[model samples]
Structure formats: structure tokens, C-alpha cells
Target: MFRLAHISDVHLGPLPAVTYRDLASKRVVGYVNWQRNRRRHMVDALTDTLVADLKASEPGHIAVTGDLVNLALDGEIELARLWLETLGPPHDVSLVPGNHDAYVPGAFGKACRSWSAWMSGDGEEGPVSRDTFPYLRVRENIALIGVSTARATAPFMASGFFREGQAARLEKILEETAGRGLCRVVMIHHPPVRGAVSQHKRLFGVGRFQKAMRRCGAELILHGHSHLPSLYHLDGAGGKIPVVGVAAAGQAPGGSHPAAQYNLLDIDGGKGDWRIRLTRRGLTGTALPLADLEAVELSGKAAAFVRN
Candidate 1:
């Protein structure tokens, strides 16, 4: 069995000193929000503990679904790179960006340059950029596809975009990977399903995303932006595709949002008969140890899938 651990929205804390120039644009609003609200709930110590527990599980691979930084500051981006190293080497960890990573017009590009190693596809070399989306990485019988929905938005807006160009490319990748009999696992920063988040934070062009999936299909879908543990399904050509979201990895216990958590997926079997067991583990409270909260067994073919 291949054990894949999923974590997202670390939002590495202890905000690095920000210069006046750093907050010239949309970042000013983000900076104020972090200081007034975010810093209190998203703790670095909590994130550290969660990462330690995740490493102990010894999964075959790890998937990080973005929002690694709070303000997309240069310092924060560098700090996040160091944090990613602690999780695992680039080859063992795959990442996609979130809206906060692209908080400003040029911030996303900087993040892509710094975190390229963990986002590049197998055998992809040289400087990686924003255009390198829908990248493919093959591990054992699984095909991990990284899609980028992250984009810069106006102040107070936290939306993602799924353009037609990326959608077309994704469909091709899904079809090709499915033909290889590999379990296709698509990773995006935003939940593709509608109503996953509020209007200002929703994923725009979701119809294009759904259309692509319905044509080619995927074994499993993982996302992060909502910072809430959620499970939704999409109608795919083969069957129902499972789309899942997890809480922020740095969220403190007893926060307004769900506490920090990660999903451990055990994947076994082959193409048409794949079995995925999702085990969610995280902090229940400030005094308790990280523990398993729930488990659900999912099947590649939706008709035979079971939920509990």
C-alpha cells in the first residue's frame, strides 16, 4: 500500500518584519488582518507539532496544498522554504499554491521560484514558473497531478481561478494517466466544487473544472483553501470523484475554524479496483494529544464506494 499524507495552509507564523514598501498594495490589508486576528490563532508551535507527528507516520509521500505564508513577504516565503525542507525532500513532497501565496500581483511568481523544487514534475529541471501547472509525477501506481488555482485578488478577496487553458491541459493529463491504469490524484489549492467557500473566496470558473473532470475523471482530488475539513464528490466519466479538504496545519486548538489536521490516505489495488482509506488525525484540544478523528474507505469506482 502507498501511504500519502496531506497537509495544507500552514500559514507559517511569527510574521517577518515588514517594510513600508511591502505593504504598499493589497498586502497592507493582509498585514493588518494578520496582526489583528490571524496571528493569535495560527501558531507556529502547533504547526511544528503536527509536522512531527506526520513524519512519525512515515507516509510514502506528502501533499501540501498551499497558503504556506501569511503575507507572501519575501521573508515569509524564505521561512516557508525552510519549513518544507523539514517535512521532506522535494521528491517526497508535492505542493500547489493557494490564494494567499499570490496575495499580490508579483508575490506568486516569487513563491513559485522559491518553492519550485517541491512543485516540479518528475525529471523537470531548470527554473520553474507559474505556467508549469498540471505537472505530473508518477510514484508506484499513482499519478499525482498538481494544478494551480492560485491568483492575486483585490483586498478582502480570496478567490481562485481555473482558466480554460489549464482546464484543457488537465483533461489531457487525466485521460492519459487513466489509460496507464494509474490512480490519478489531482491536487489543487481551491475546492473545485461550488459552495465550498463564500462568494468572495470561491473558485471562479468552476464549471470549466467540472467539465474537464467529467470528461477524463480522477481517482481522488485534494484541496486546502477553505481551512475546514470537508468532503465533496463530483460526477466523473468513470464514477464519482472524491474531493477532500483539510483544516489549516497551523491553526491553534479552539480557534474559530477547526483545529489543525491532516489526512493520511492509504491507497491500494489497481486502476479499476483502487481502495483509498482516509484517516484524519489532529488536535482535539489544547490539552489532548494528536489523535485519529475519523476514517472513511473510498473506492475508485463510485458505484461500489462505501462511506462511514
Candidate 2:
């Protein structure tokens, strides 16, 4: 079995000193919110403990579904680059940015440059200067597809966007990978089903996303902008595509949101048939080991929701 771990919305913190210029735009409100409330909830200590436990399990590959920084400050991007190295080398980890990672007009480019190695395509001959998704990383028998729904918006907006061009390219990638009998797993920052999140925080291209999947097909989908642990499925041409949303990896317990958690997926089989076992390890009051959480098995090709 190929063991893969999924974590998202790390939101690395302790805001670096900001100049009036840095907070001159919509970021000023974000800075105020961070000082007033976010500092209390999203703590680095919680993230440190979670990372230690995550590394101990030692999965073959890790998928980080973004929000690595809060305000997308220049310093935050650099700090997050170091943080990504601590997770694992670029080859071992695949990442897609979330809304927070794209939190301003020009911050997305900086974030991409900092995390480029972790987001490159397997076919690339050399290192990428900037990230262009949906990038494909074909590992073992699984095709890891990284899509970006991360886009900066105005104040009070936490939305994501995936344009038509990206959708068309993603469909082609899905077709090629599926034809190779690989389990195609698409990772993005925003949920891609109707009613997955509030309107303001939703993926504007959910309809386009579903349309692309309906045309092609993928075995699984993973996203993290909502900061909630949720499971939704799409009836794809090949079978049901499972779309899962993970809570913020650094979030503490007993708040309006769920505690920090991550999912480990054990996938096996090939071609027309694939089997997957999902294990969710998380922190309630204290952190739990991998064996502590219940495991759900996805057996047979089309029956993704079956717990078995």
C-alpha cells in the first residue's frame, strides 16, 4: 500500500513587525484581526506538537493543502519556506495554496517562489521559477494532481477562484492519468462542491470544477480552506470522487471550529480497481497517535463512500 498523509491550513504565525506600508491595503484589517483574535486561536505550540507526531508516523508522501502563512507578509513567506523544509524534502511533500497564502494583490507570486520545489511537476526538467497549477506529480501508482484555487480578494473576503483554462488543463491531466491506470488524487485549497462553505468563502468555480470532473474523472480530491473536516462526493464518469476538507492544522481545541487534524490514506490495487483505507489522527484535548483514530476503508472502484 502507498501511505500518504494530508494536512492543511497550517497558518504559520507570530506576525513579523509590519511597516505602515505593509498594512496600507486590505491587510490593515487583517493585521488588526490577527492581534485581536487570531493570535489566541492559531498557536505555533499546537503546530509543533502536531508536526512531531506527524513525522513519527513517517508516511511515504505528505500533501499540504495550504494556508502556510496568515497575512502573506514577505517575512511570513520566508518563514513558511523554512517550515516546509522541516515537514520534509520537496519530493516527499506536495502543496497547494489556500486563500490566506494568496492574501493580497502580489503576495501569491512571492509565496509560489518560496514553495516552488514542493509544487513542481514530475515531467519538469529543472526547477520552476514560479508555480503553475494544476501541476502533476506521478508517484508510484498514484497521480498527485495539485490545483490552485487560491486567489486574493478584498477585505472580509476569503474566497478562491479557478478559471476555465485551468479547468480544461486539469481535465486533460485526469484523462491521461486515469488512462495509465493510476489513482488520480486532486489537491486544491478550496472545496469544489455545492454548499461546501459559506458564500463569501466558497470556490466560485465549483460548477466548473464539477463540470471538469464529470467530463474526465479522478479517484479522490482534497482541500482545506474551510478549516473543517468534511466529506463530500461527486459522481464522476469513472466513479464517485471523494472530496475531503481538513481543519486548520494549527487550530486549538474548544473554539468555534474543530481541533487540528490530518488524514492518512493507504491506497492499493490498480487499473479498474483500487482500494483505500483512511485514518484520521487528530488532537482533541491532547494529540492522538495514528493508531488511535478509526479507519475507514474505500473498497471497489466506484464505491468511495463505503466504510467497509
What tens digits encode model 2's per-residue C-alpha lDDT throughout 1-308? Answer: 89888999898899999999998888998898988877888978878877777778788899999899989999999999999999999899999888888899888888877888898888675544323688999889999999998888999999989898888889989999988889999999888987888988988888899999888978888889888878778878877777877878888877678788888888999887788777777775654542335456666443334331
Q: Rate the local accuracy (lDDT) of all candidates.
A: 0.90, 0.84
In order of listing, the candidates' clash counts read: 0, 0
Task: List residue ranges in candidate 1 displaced over 4 A.
Answer: 300-308
Off by over 4 Å in 2: 125-131, 286-291, 300-308
**Residue 132 in candidate 1 has what lDDT?**
78
Model 2 clash pairs?
A: none
* Residue 178, model 2: Cα distance from true site in angstroms: 0.9
lDDT of 1 by residue, 1-308 (tens): 99999999999989888899888899999988998888899998888888899999999999999899988999999999998898899999999999988889888999999999999999989777756788999999999999999989999999999998888889988988988999999999999999999999999989999999899989899999999988899999889999989999989876789998999999999978888998888987775579888788777544333333
